[model samples]
Target: MARIMSGVQPTGNLHIGNYLGALVNWVRLQDQYEAYFSIVDLHALTGRPEPAALRHAVREVAIGVLASGVDPERATVFVQSHVPQHTELAWVLTCLTPLGDLNRMTQFKDKSQHQPDNINTGLFTYPVLQTADIVLYRADRVPVGEDQEQHLELARETVRRFNHVYGETFPEPQVVKSSAPRVMGLDGESKMSKSRNNEIGLFETADETMLKLRGAKTDPARLRKTDKGTPEVCNIYSYHGFFTGEVQRAAIATGCRSAQLGCVDCKKLLAQNLEVVKGPIRERAAVLREQPRRLEEILAAGAHRARAEAEKTMVLVRERVGLGAPRS
Candidate 1:
């Protein structure tokens, strides 16, 4: 099977957009690929999270991944910090990467501007570390969103530069995109994000989910109950490409255009449809929460497994770069 690697930052709550866009695809991808899914804690540090929040968020994100059905038996699921080679290799790749290349990255610029008060070196050099994460396992494919296209391309460039300088030790990674991506936030002004207060947590109770949805943005053109909506432009309808079925979506579309349904009524239908998907996930997460040791065991085992392969690659890399034999 072809190896695939991807990661999620343990920054905040997993939302509906995350579920439909990323996590759901991860679940489906495991059956077809040798997957390594990681909680990218080191990557999150550049964002400058509080220590306690980072710890809690990392564990909670891990819990969410397991609850969301990233089976350890199916994929290598671990934290980035567990495997030290990720950093050690990152250092090597950084040496190969050019300053001009890092400066040109758009995400780096955006995130850097957002945190102008504390623009750390880590933030500037993260793309190299990202390359290390993918190339450490020699992953051939990575599932990515539109926002990550440039970063993925940079990772490939880093791999190519290293191969040209020190001989080919890593393969360039490719992207696999999702078609039915969840795009809108609770505010519906931009992508779902914690900073924007536009997300519904994956483990939120049914009532909480409904409450969030009720307050969320929908087509503003249909302010009155009798007004007809264009489901084509509505975020709620956009979500249905994943949450609701073919028939449900068709009905919603028809109802919206024909003025047969109100926004409240449409939201009610989506909330109900959501339960059918999130119900089992919530149950599994609760079970895992009770057995916290299981998460530790899985992570330790993943680190151990990942280390073996990463070490082998490092040995070969060291020899290619004329670092000579391993110390006795």
Candidate 2:
């Protein structure tokens, strides 16, 4: 099986946007690849989360991953910080990465602008670490959203540079984009992000999910039941595309575009359908929460397996780069 790597930040509850966007697709690939799913706690440090919050975030993310059907046995699921090789390799890649290359990363620019008060070296060197995360595992296929395509390109560039100087030790990683919904936020404005405060969490209880969906925006053109609204233009209808079946989606689309359904009626339908999907996830998360030791055991074992593989890779890397064994 081909090796694949992907990471999720342990910042907050991964919302529906995460589910429909990435986790859903990851579940399908678990059996098809030697997958490594990581709770990227180190990556979350750039934003400077509090210690307690960070720890909680890590557990929550792990729970979410397990609940989402990423089998620990099938795919290596561990916290990124557990594998020190990631940071170690990142330093090597950092040296080869040019300032201009990091400067051009659009995500770096966007995130830096958001945190002008605390823009640190970690933020600037973010992509270098990201490059190491993929190449450290020698992953050939990386599942990415449209937003991360640029960074993936940079990782490929770093591989080319390293091969040019140090000889070919790592393969250039490939992008494996998910076919799920592109972007789904709570407020229906921008990407569903915890920082954006515009996300409906995947693990939210049925009541909580419905509450958030209740006041969610709809076609402004839909002021009343009688008025017609275009489902093609409505954000709520877009959501239906994820949870609703093909037959139901076609029906909703036709009804919405024809103004046969009011915005509230449309949203009510979406909320109901969404609950049906999220109900089981919520139940699974509850079960995981009740067993904290289980989550820890999963992580400990995953870290052990990941460390063994990383150590083997680093041995060859040291030899290829003419570095001797560790000093006593």
Candidate 3:
């Protein structure tokens, strides 16, 4: 099986956007590929999160990943910092990466604008580290959202540059696009993110989820209960496309267009469908949280597996780049 690698940052609680956009796909892909999924704690550092909060977030994100059905036995699941070779390889790749490429990255520009006071080198070179994260595993494919397409392209370019200079040391990883590539937040104007406070947490109780849904933005054209709504323009309807069945989604769409389903009723239906998926995940996460030792063991085992693979790649990289002592 071709190897695929992907990761989630331990920045905040995993949300429904995460579930539909990434984690759900990760669960399905595990059986078809040699999968490596990491809680990328190193990447999370750019946000300058509090030390204790970061540690707590990492554990919580691990629970979220495991509870979402990413089996440890099927996929190598580890913390990114646990294997030092990621940053080690990142430095090597960073040297090969062009400054112009980093400058052109829209994400870097957006992030810089978001945190102008803290525009550090790490923020600028984020893509280079991401390139290292994938190629360090010699991952043949990477599951990426629409937002990361540019970064993946850069990864491919960096790999090609390394190959041109040092021979074919790594494969150019291909993209495995998610089914729901860009899940909009409840605001319906931007991507779902914890920073925006527009996300519904994956582990939230049914009541909590429903409360958020109640205030979610729908079609602006929808003026009242009897007004016909456009499901295509409604973020809630987009959500139904992911969580709700085809038959029900079609019914919902018809109901929406016909003014039969009010926004409140529509949101309630979405809340119910969401619970069908998240309820089990939340329960599983609770069990994992109660057993912190078990979570550590899984992460440790995964790191051991990941480190072994990373070392193999580094050995070749060292030899190719003439980094280590001369071979006798």
Residue pairs whose backbone atoms clash in candidate 3:
none
Q: Write the per-residue lDDT of candidate 2 for residues 31-127, one digit (tens) a residue.
A: 8899988888999999999999999999988998899888998999989999998998898789889899998888888898889988989998988
Q: How does each model score on lDDT?
A: 0.86, 0.85, 0.93
Off by over 4 Å in 1: 180-182, 324-328
Report residue 69 deviation for candidate 1 (angstroms). Answer: 1.4
Query: Regarding lDDT, does 1 or 3 come out ahead?
Result: 3
Can you write out model 1's per-residue Cα lDDT over 1-328, one digit (the tens) per residue? 9999988888887776677767888899999999999889999999889999998888888888888988898889889999988998898888888899999889888887878897999999988888899999999999988888888999998888888888777888999897544477878787887767888778887788899989878888988878888998888887777789999899999999999988988988888888888888888888988988988999899888888888888888778777765565
lDDT of 3 by residue, 1-328 (tens): 9999999999889998888888999999999999999899999899889999999999999999999999999999999999999998999998998789998999998888877888888998999999999999999999999999999999999999999999999999999989889989999989999988899999999999999999999999998999999999999998998889999999999999999999999999999999999999999999999999999999999999999999999999988988993244
Q: Once model 1 is optimally superposed onto the true structure by TM-score, how far is the C-alpha of residue 82 displaced, in angstroms? A: 0.4
Error of 2 at 52 (Å): 0.4
